[model samples]
Target: MAMRKAKVQEQVVQAVARSNPGDRLVATVHGISGPAPQLTMAFGFIMLFVVKYYFVTVTERAVVVHRAAKFTGRPGDVVFNLPREQAHGIASEVRHGRQWNSFRLLFPGAAKPTRINVAAPWANDLGRLLSALGAAAPASG
Candidate 1:
C-alpha cells in the first residue's frame, strides 16, 4: 500500500511538473471533495459513494487539486490551480476526539469554493501541508 501510494504521488508530481516545470512539489493531502459540515452524518457513506477523491497538492507556485482516480489514485484532471494568494481560510478542528481539517478552496474566477474534508491519519499531515501552502503564499501588501 505504501509503495502504491508513493508511486501515485510521483505520478501526480510528474503531471503537475509538466505544466509547472519550475515549481517544485511540496505536499499533498487526499481529501473527500465536499462540505465537511454536510457530510458529518454520512461521512463514511459519502466516502464510499465517492468515485474519486481530491489529490490536493501544494507546490512552490500554487495549490493544485486534482480528481484522483480509484485503485491507482493517479490524478485525472487539473480541477483547481489556486494562486498562493487565494490559499486562505482552512482550519483544523477536533471533533469527537478526532482531528479534522476542513477548507473551501476558492479558485480564481470560480463561482464557489471547493469544500475539502480531511480526516485523521491523512489529517495528520495537515500541519506541514498547510505550512507549505502558507509559506508560498504571496504577502498581502
Candidate 2:
C-alpha cells in the first residue's frame, strides 16, 4: 500500500515538473500589447489548472489526510481519520491547532502554525473531493 502511494505521489511531482520547465521564467505582461496580453492570461490559466489538478496527501499510522490547497494549502482541510493521537502538541497548527489573533486558543501551543497551502482557489471543492474519498472508505475507527 505504501509503495503504491509513493508511486502515485512521484507521478504527480513528475507531471508538475514537466508542465513547468522553468519555475521563474514567466514573461512580463505590463509593457506590451497583443502577445503580452496572452502572457498575463497564461499566468492565470496555468495557475488555475495547477490549483484544480494538484492534490496533497499525508498518511499517518491510523489515518490519512488529503489536502488540495495548491499553493495555498491549509491544514484544516486535513481530515482526521484516527482519534487515538492527541489533538495537540504536533508541529502542524492546522492539525494540532494554535493561537489566533492573540485571543482564540488553537491547540494551545506557542509555536505559530505552519501554512502548507496546496494552492486551491476555493475550500468547497476540496471538501467535496474529500467527502467522496471518505465515502469510499467509511472509516472503521
Which is the leading candidate under TM-score?
Answer: 1
In model 1, the worst 10-residue window by lDDT is 89-98
lDDT of 2 at 25: 14
Q: What is the lDDT of candidate 1?
A: 0.63
* Candidate 1, 1-141: lDDT as tens digits: 122556767888888887678888878777666546345446755565553477788888778878876555678788878766667643223222155555555555767766666655555455567667553221111
RMSD to true structure for each model, in Å: 6.2, 16.6
Q: Name the lDDT value of residue 57 in candidate 1.
A: 84
Model 2 vs. true fold: TM? 0.20
- TM-score per candidate, chains pooled: 0.66, 0.20
